[model samples]
Target: MTGPGRGTTADTPVVVAARRTPIGTAGGALRAVTVDALAAPVLAALAGTLGGPVDDVLLGNVFGPGGNPARVAALAAGLGDDVPGMTVDRQCASGLAAILTAAAGIRAGDGAGYLAGGAESPSTTPTRTWADGTVYTRAPFAPTGDPDPDMGPAADDVAVRAGLSRRRLDAFAARSHARAVDAQRSGRFDDELVPVGAVLTDERPRDRFTPERLARFRPAFTPGGVHTAANSCGVNDGAAAVALVPEWRRRELGVPGLALVSAATRGCPPADLGLGAVPALAALRDRPRSPDAVEFTEAFAGQALACLDAAGIDGHRVSPDGGAIALGHPWGASGAVLVVRLFHRLVVQGRGETGIAALSSGGGLGVATSWRVVR
Candidate 1:
């Protein structure tokens, strides 16, 4: 487990070039596309720019294909026959875990060289069936009954325990929309997105939001569910890919946005697993000059606040442009999506230097990752 700051006898890993599809709501443009299909163009874009096959392909898919999705996406995107793939599931933290694994592969001098990024999709998501004739929903937010309480109900539970009020949730949703609008208007996302050819039957690239648009949606979970469409992470479709430089060749192909800071992934108690980020707080609290230095991108408004409060993060610095609440969530790719968004905000704009993407997931589990932009 040799990692950053261990005097680990090598340079920390860095991102060479990274790009993602503009996220869109399900049944939208990419709705008909396969989870791997959405990712193909993104992989092609990165490869075309980088001029070769990547070191590997790592995917973060929670509910789609059950067998070797990472490898499938790798082959689908023209990554070449030799490149291997690893599919990881960390609830929502899957994408960052993939990124870190790729980074570690490079730092380990294992000759892994470069890695491609990925996340989940639900529109064409893989569905499961039982002999009893019951169907299981696989879309990002597909609501399937659970013998155990689920993330939505769990959010209600967290709300009751944390005493989060309806007013706060509404306000947070509003701010998320406003900030997402700001991000789009200011073109904060221009650099992060790749122009995957127009999704068939679609005209726009990324999901668009506004405070007013969210204000009209009603509650979702319960008859009077505390969570509303605007207040929750929208069911969305998208893909992301980033290249990692091999330690042996970092200097020769030094890309403009190269950066290596630190990252960690942790687990949370299952019963209240949606509250996973609790551990990430202590992991990053003592960071250098990291004061007033906290930023987080989470999948849900209720849990993001609850987890941050649970982790004792400084509230002011969290997802300045709003998160899933505004940007929408594509499940499997969520962890990586949040970190890339944070990295771009920090590296591209002049946002906080240190940021954390932490959140809980469906099962009694959660994870977090840390990142610092290359200066």
Candidate 2:
């Protein structure tokens, strides 16, 4: 990857605005909200802030009624008929992938402005069945003969391989919840939230999970695994979007934002999908100068700890305002959620000058993006 701050200022891609709907657990508060419905308000909020026509709208989504949920959301948001939309589905990395795709376009000088992020309403995802009427929960992540364990089992394997103990994983999970609860109590999330319907705050993140309490739960994925339901992220519904433009446009608007430094996506063994983020972050070559802020999607306590350890990142330096483990992981939207969090910390709050957002995805894929605060 190119060194940070290597590109011409005029050609750099900048994120001007970011927003997200309150995350609700699957079949909970957001159960009635469809994928398009969840995204429309977020898109509208971003468009309203930018006060201009969007050249394109890109959204990441896992499941919906199909036929391009991004297009449906754009139309629903009242973006002009001329505006086009694209949907990305890289599993958990979809949101970040969509944003990076838009950034690539801006760097290529293809468009003046774009709206990109991810949205998901797992509660309303349509059930699928084969022609013979056999039901399937999800699609295959690897070809036959390749190891493609479910995320829970894969996370367990990751912890076992990394020699991470259950106590350590439980502590991490409890910390995530505690931090999120504190942030919520302090109104740290108020600025970035876009209320959908009557939901004003995240529906997860209770202060009840101490490490001692979490230890009471039995193994969830394997017979003697370190993973447990309490330590893993919950399936949820939410949407997050960001307004992107070239540095020239941002300069004209005089809006503070995040300037894209570098982004990378890498592949790893399907069986060890949780470690996917390690190589992706390594590819950025941002060593020697650590990012002042880092946000990694915490899909599971064990998986997150394992990845951070392997990547040589200090676990305590990640997600100071908590993470997916506490906020809830709306599969398709989690990666984008990480970016949204970074925007809040680095640009909105002036907490840091440089930040990194990274996440592991199904199918052995990982996505990472580095950003610098632009005032």
Candidate 3:
């Protein structure tokens, strides 16, 4: 499915390296770690995997503590001072945007190869002081319109417009948790999730997830709304990194079975829009028929479903292993996280159909990438 001169073929794009920080709920140990420390371990792991220095490091970050994120992460990860880097900011889609940028660079022969990935600590968010003296972090960036509204209001409006019932929404959320529990039990995520050692103040490192405890928290965005704290994604801390190597150079480093497939980027109207995933889906599903399956990060269960419906695909075809609702959505990291999850699913499922990963960002933007299973 890969075209010639596209830096890919029918072979798997070699994943030279892969690593991630343990995902913690907001205000967790990762909050204790600096952004540089937050991103360094994963990059270091990637460098060690490739056996040498890489050409560039692409990072996806929504809220950095302060200072230049890409440079800080690169330096903290032990890259040379001269090594180039770029920080991507496309809202939630920033991670996938970063991946596309790095992939394009390698495909264009800009450098020997490159690293593309994302990191986020939504826990340590940057707050803004409004004239009313209300401190907020994510409100200013959520959807807005004539009356103006935050993401929650926009989501409520989306639900109303889509005719999504509370019953249906609850079912969707329940399904996500069930699937995640199953995937974890079946070892589907073991291949990707990295466990990090940490100290909680003066205490020892302990597991962060406890289903019983997680079930106790109430809704975050809309307290009385259908999206509960248990169901809705929260501020989280985690980092993921991947290496992209051109097909021709696969043998030089003894890495094989990897390639950059096809990708598409597009813009949509900015508003409390009803459908954000249409343009990107239309572009990637350009070949013959609808995509075999749609893999989207669960920014919100209903909103994610809206995109699938807009694309004219069954919602069931999306996120078979659960989504942000269960795995947690860390804003900028969700885009690349979707790609990484899709890649793993394609590799393990032994299916031949192409997969599409699409995400909607703030400011009416949608981006998608297509990956053909390398057999």
lDDT of 3 at 193: 61
Q: Show model 1 residue runs off by greater than 4 Å.
A: 1-9, 48-53, 138-147, 199-217, 223-225, 246-248, 256-260, 285-297, 350-352
Candidate order (TM-score):
2, 1, 3
Best by lDDT: 2
lDDT of 1: 0.64
Ranking by lDDT: 2, 3, 1
Tens digits of per-residue lDDT, candidate 1, 46-112, equal 6654434466777777776777777877788787899788888765667766777787777776644
Using TM-score as the yardstick, the better of models 2 and 3 is 2
Question: Which has the better lDDT: candidate 1, or candidate 3?
Answer: 3
Q: How does candidate 2 score on lDDT? A: 0.89
TM-score of model 2 relative to the true fold?
0.97
Against the true structure, what is every candidate's RMSD?
Answer: 4.6, 2.5, 4.9
Q: How much lDDT does each candidate structure score?
A: 0.64, 0.89, 0.65
Q: Per-residue lDDT for 365 in model 1?
A: 54
Better of 1 and 3 by TM-score: 1
Best by TM-score: 2
Residues 157-186 of candidate 3: C-alpha lDDT, one tens digit per residue: 666677776556656666766777677667
